[model samples]
Target: MPKITDQVSDSGIYLLEIVVPDDFYTEIKKYEGRKFPKGFYYYAGSAQKNMRKRLERHLKKNKNIYWHIDYLTSRFNIGKIFYFNNCGKEFECDLVADLIEKFGLIPAAPGFGNSDCNRCDSHLLYSEAPLDYSHFISRYQSIARFIPSSNDTF
Candidate 1:
């Protein structure tokens, strides 16, 4: 399993890529077209099962916001969140992180992580690849399955 880390929020434009199973689409639809308040970082994360449950945790008003997304969401109106159905596993986090970085995005949480994220002593694993962010944007647009058309320019 890859280690997950939290970053110091920079309040930069961020793209959250959440992976969900096909059955979770219904729940994802609830927040479709919803924009999180600005100054707040959008909380984005993935689950191997039960997207609703995981998302619910994020929505909980009383919960402690540990993840970058959670803390950020509390402050900013999530400009938009992209949901990718049928995705599972932690390695994908790295992929999504790379994609987000391709757009020259900065880390909401920059220095926090464990061994899984740091495969080497000198480099962080999540920082390994130059994300093809545009590819994902295009894929979401082409499929039409993703909520809030990418053209909306959130």
Candidate 2:
């Protein structure tokens, strides 16, 4: 299916919601030296002006592994991409914090995709089951949208 988004702003926070298959968890641990259990993960990030470019780059399989998120996105498919467009730059970590505090999400890998963030243990959050995206958005109280697929080109 074609990826859809409601791009109403130039910048805000986003969550790359991905599912790591049970068997692939071992491969990720071996390659990245990080223990990630089989489950859903949410990686919170932000863009100042080029949110589309950033999101597009993240969904591609063929890209140079620059950021920690690149390691996972290069291998696993992002099941969903959530965009919170009305927030400021600081909302990236805020989103992660909310996931942990309200939704009981746990940090998967320390310093994973949050090198500059001191507020979060990791940008990547883990849960055994899928996070209720709509519920989370209702609690978030901000302008948001979600792209249902990641593999398809925009």
Candidate 3:
């Protein structure tokens, strides 16, 4: 397990906890006619360089929507962020797979945030109930640092 840091750094895997207040439908680029239900969602991603900048971009309301997660972040609110610094991209896929295996979470959008990934179904996981971050950490035995939306400086 890697050391979790408070500030986002060069390389790591991150999980964004987002809230969707109402049900809606949107065409997520290639994933057309997808329905986003009203609930909590966990989006996993990895940034090999400029991780802090990437996270800052996600925290912002206005930006160029290049990624699928950007589409959701533009519309929804990210409540929390859990990240493990120095973790590789492969860890991201493992985390997503673990979420599905343990929590039986389904993809909010197929092929979302994982266009470059060939191993995972999707990087975004949906659940009606709030996810237990501590449980996830213990299950994976991986250290993670929490960043609330209120404390996002960048």
Give per-model TM-scores. Answer: 0.44, 0.85, 0.87
Instruction: Please give, for residues 34-56, the per-residue lDDT of candidate 2 as tens digits.
Output: 45678898899988787877888
| Residue-by-residue lDDT tens digits, candidate 3, 23-119 | 8786565766766789999999999988888887887888888888888888888888888889988999998988888977878777888989999
Model 1 ranges with Cα > 4 A deviation: 1-44, 59-62, 66-68, 112-116, 119-135, 140-145, 149-154
What C-alpha lDDT, on a 0 to 100 scale, does residue 131 get in candidate 3?
82
- For candidate 1, lDDT tens digit of each residue in 109-132? 333222234421211122223335
Q: Could you give me the TM-score of model 3 versus the true structure?
A: 0.87
lDDT of 2: 0.78
Off by over 4 Å in 2: 1-8, 23-32, 150-154
Cα misplacement distance, residue 151 of candidate 2 (Å): 11
Clashes of 1: 18
Tell me the RMSD of model 3 versus the true structure. 4.4
Error of 3 at 47 (Å): 0.2
Candidates in order have lDDT scores of 0.36, 0.78, 0.81
Q: How much is 88 displaced in model 3, in angstroms?
A: 1.0
Could you tell me which residue pairs clash in candidate 2?
A: none
